[model samples]
Target: MLERLFESTLWNSRFIVILAVVFGLIGAVILFAVASIDIIVTAKYVVATYLSGTHPENFHQDVIGGIIGAVDLYLIGVVMLLFAFGLYELFISEIDVAKESEHDETQLLAIHSLDQLKDKISKVIVMVLVVGFFQKVGYTQYSGALDMLYLALSITAVSVGLYFLGKVGK
Candidate 1:
């Protein structure tokens, strides 16, 4: 089923990209909305309403703050999820690696091709992971951009590896 998913039309289609963009857009909107909530809530309740003698309960403050914070965090999470799905849609495609493994024979081109592919993939992965770690630590946005590039390159390597196998299979 997992293999089929990578091979599916849904994955290759533009629909997935559109869905991902929408999710990111919604998340951004949520973030923008909640960011102003703090100012508005404090201004209205602490200043304007206070002069009118409408003091709210203290415990309610914590509850409301927590709820708003949670919503903000959830929006960020949703954005990340959508961006990840976008990356998957852009870079990943299916080739039956299992099929390659099951074959009893090997050709020189297959071996060399696989070796080169492995080298390229491993280097790219390590580089991207290192960059991603830095990005996670908030050092730079460039690292995050590089991570997307690496993901695309990794997918291309995989496709090339599969093509090599096809050539050797013949």
Candidate 2:
């Protein structure tokens, strides 16, 4: 009887993972708030620039980079959200609210297994990386054809990698 009881206790300890879900949710909220603030600040900058009627050198590119950075933050927030939801569903239980919703077919937070969760988070992370790369490239000055060629080659490599990732499981 003691052995059975100990085994039961050990098995039930898996609920401790709910702490992970809680922390993940909190982190996601913070990230989303930061991303929102970033976009709002970027918008304010754009409006001020427009009203001032001054096209300083690289102003447009600067604005674009700001927007892309904001997008990267938003994507990271999304990744956190997906991680939280996926962990909760995978380790705890299926989300009943999602199943009951009419939009169940289109739900993004659904995860039936660890692999699905990994796939979802990994894809968003790649997107965030791509956005970050673009933001950095936007500020970089290309001094020669060689620099541009290098940039093109870097983009091609990223594209190929993304293509292969997509082709996985097919």
Largest TM-score belongs to which candidate? 2
Local accuracy of candidate 1 as per-residue lDDT tens digits, 1-170 = 98898678665674555655566666656665665575466455556655887665553454455444544444454444435333433444322452367665322113224344444334434444443333343322335778878766866776675566556524
Q: Which pairs of residues have clashing backbones in candidate 2?
A: none
Error at 29, model 1, angstroms = 1.2
Which 10 consecutive residues of model 2 have the lowest summed lDDT?
A: 101-110
Q: Per-model C-alpha lDDT, please?
A: 0.49, 0.87
On a 0 to 100 scale, what is the lDDT of residue 87 in model 2?
Answer: 86
Cα RMSD (angstroms) for every candidate in the order listed: 19.5, 1.5
lDDT for each residue of candidate 2 in 1-170, tens digit (9 for 90 to 100):
99999999998888998998899889888988888888888888888989999877888897897788878888998898898899889888888888888884637888988999999899999989988888898889999999999999999988998899888778
Worst 10 residues of 1 by lDDT: 105-114
Best by lDDT: 2
